[model samples]
Target: MAVPPALETPESDGDATSGGPEDLQRQSWTRRTFGAVIENPHFRNLFIGNIFQFGSMQMQLVVRSWLVFHITGSFAALGTVALANAIPGLLLSPVGGLIADRAPKKTIIQSAQIYNMANAAVLAALAAGWLGVELAFWHLFLSSFLQGGVNSIMMPSRQSMISDLVPRDRLMNVIGINSSGQTFMQLVGPGIAGFLIAALSPAAVFGVMAALYFFAVTFTMRLPTKPLYAFAQSDAGRAAKQARSGGRRSNGFKDLKDGMRYVATDPTIRMLIMVNFLIVVVAMPYTMLLAGFVKDILHKGAFEQGILQSVQGLGAVGGSIFIASSASKGRGKMMIGWGALLGVGIVAFSISTSFWITLPIMIFIGAAQAGRMAIGQVLVQSYSEEEYRGRVQSVWFMQFSLVQFGTFLVSILAEFAGPQVAIGGLAALLVLAMGLIALFVPAMRRLD
Candidate 1:
């Protein structure tokens, strides 16, 4: 497929109508990279909605992790709660993907936001003592479980919706842009969350998250609904005909099994997701156990954790922007490169004890995480047919929950070897594994 003209690489020309040579070049760059998506009002609305969601999610992570640690004060407990949250994704992401395939994407997204808003509000209410029940870890666990379920369903719909909103050729560029914005939010959200938690109670922090979720709802309402149901070759028409003829079966398990079978059969998508899974397994436990790292390893507070998280945001922003501005050729090599870079950062992070040293390394870690995961996602979407897009993405996204198991393992290793050595040693092994794959896996290296 030809690349979309809107997202084609800009050629520098000394044009006088728009601006001078330098100014024209900058404008051309912006047009090719961002304008391809932003110029479309629907994309703009989707971007805004996603910004609120991403920011809210980051802030929620900070607040929730802090709360969990405050109450339990155990790395094992924190890891367990994180694992509990992953359970829902393991069980429901494919179902969500199936829904994304068969339903209105925007409706799925907006509905999830509404439920998330309610969930946040309830947590806030419990913290405020309005619920007439004592706040406990179980309460938080319940909230996490519900959020996980909704997220599993909502994410695929939102992801699939992007392909419908823009030309297929522009999908990766737009995903790059969106992931970059998400990384940017990671920079801002946790800093604000730390301050909020310090100044007020969990009630106020969660109330703010509720407000952000509501903003996501309002922002989504502005997006064009046309694309939510947009399907090639009149898919809706075909669906209606099938329904009338009693030819279609609404079987969730069958749909999910078929999606799994499809992914298992495709090498590009299979390796892309598998490598992504391995990387996340090795890299994510640090963030999940970050509170323990801060309190036990660094002897710091929530504020310090926020700073580290924000530093990651900085690295991720740089990494994501690089991909967004690129011509997107040789993406397979790019993914492997980012994976290797990720291991390098994690090893550095594992060995460092000082705040200053870790800050710089955190940026590298964040960049690698964003770049590798975003590229993997782009490949997953690109390799699938429209008819299977939702399910394909769902099956791919299920790897998201695998991090829970990784975190669980990290908790055990941290208990025995401490956070620094456990994470660092694991990361070193991850780097070696990635290098071996790059050297030997001809199919993976040939992804583009």
Candidate 2:
């Protein structure tokens, strides 16, 4: 089968637009790297909105995990909170993607944002004790479950819209730059959240999150309303569209089934998803468990924990920039290399007791995570047909549920084996898994 030109490098927009050497020189370094996508009015709005969206989320992670551990001092409880968040995504993400394919994605995204803002407001009230109800573990758990459901529904449309706004060839740069924005929030959101939690209360953090969520909704509302679906561009995309032409407006379940079949039958997509899933399950749980790890191992509190996350985000920002500027060849190999480095960093982090030493290791882990995340999404979207793109992304998101399950199990292991062994063992497994994939998955290695 002949690969489409979309899979290779396409003509640079710069080549056509640059008037002369003077014009090229006038473009700032930042403009040269990201101006292509950010300059789009629609992309600019979405990008700015995502900064607020991601900021709230990063802050919530720190606040929530710290609250859980502070309340129960049990690793199992932290895992349970993660599980609460994951279960809804496990069940509703596919349906969310189906809706994205059939509805105006902007509407779907804005609705979810509004829902999150309200949810955050309620949590803020509850935490403030204005209701005269003492906060309990179940309150946090229930809040997490509801918030997770909304996120599962929201993420597919948000991710799929990136391709809609940009040219196909710019997908890598756009996704990389988007990830950079996310990492930028990761750098500061948690540190600020930690400070607020220490200085005021958890209620303060929730209030800030609500404000950020409101801004996210405002920016999303500015995006031009698009049609329910775009025209299919790839040969496979056209074939998939035609196959379901008679029932193009069929019920959601049927559309979902068709999407699942498409994914199951495509070898390249299956491999890409498998590699990503395994890496996520084995290597990603450390973040979920880090709160406990910090207190127990590093003898730290909320403030130090947040600082570590900020350092990790610092490395991640750098990694995403490198990807944004990089050549679009051998991305598959590069992703695997990053995953391996992440595993190694996690292993080093697991054994380290000094906070200073762990800071640098966290930076290493963050860089690796940024590369793996940006490259994986780019590959999956690059290879999938347009009609199935949302479904593909939802499936990609299903890994979150699996990783939460992995966190739950590791938490149990930590209960018996200690955090060091529980986390280190999984990191080792990730390193081994990446090596095997590189050696055996020839098609994946040859993706570009």
Best by TM-score: 2
lDDT of 1: 0.78
| Candidate 2: regions farther than 4 A off | 1-29, 66-76, 129-136, 227-240, 246-249, 295-302, 415-418
**Model 1 — which ten-residue stretch has the worst lDDT?**
1-10
Tens-place lDDT per residue, model 2, 325-399, is: 665678788888988999999999999999999999999999999989999988888788777788888899998
TM-scores of the candidates in the order shown:
0.86, 0.88
- Per-residue lDDT over 271-340 for candidate 1, one digit per residue giving the tens place of the 0 to 100 score: 7778888888887777778877878877888778878887888889888877776665677788889988
User: In model 1, what lDDT does residue 252 have?
Assistant: 72
Which regions of candidate 1 deviate over 4 angstroms?
A: 1-27, 71-77, 226-231, 234-250, 294-302
Which prediction has the highest lDDT against the true structure? 2
**For candidate 2, what is the lDDT?**
0.82
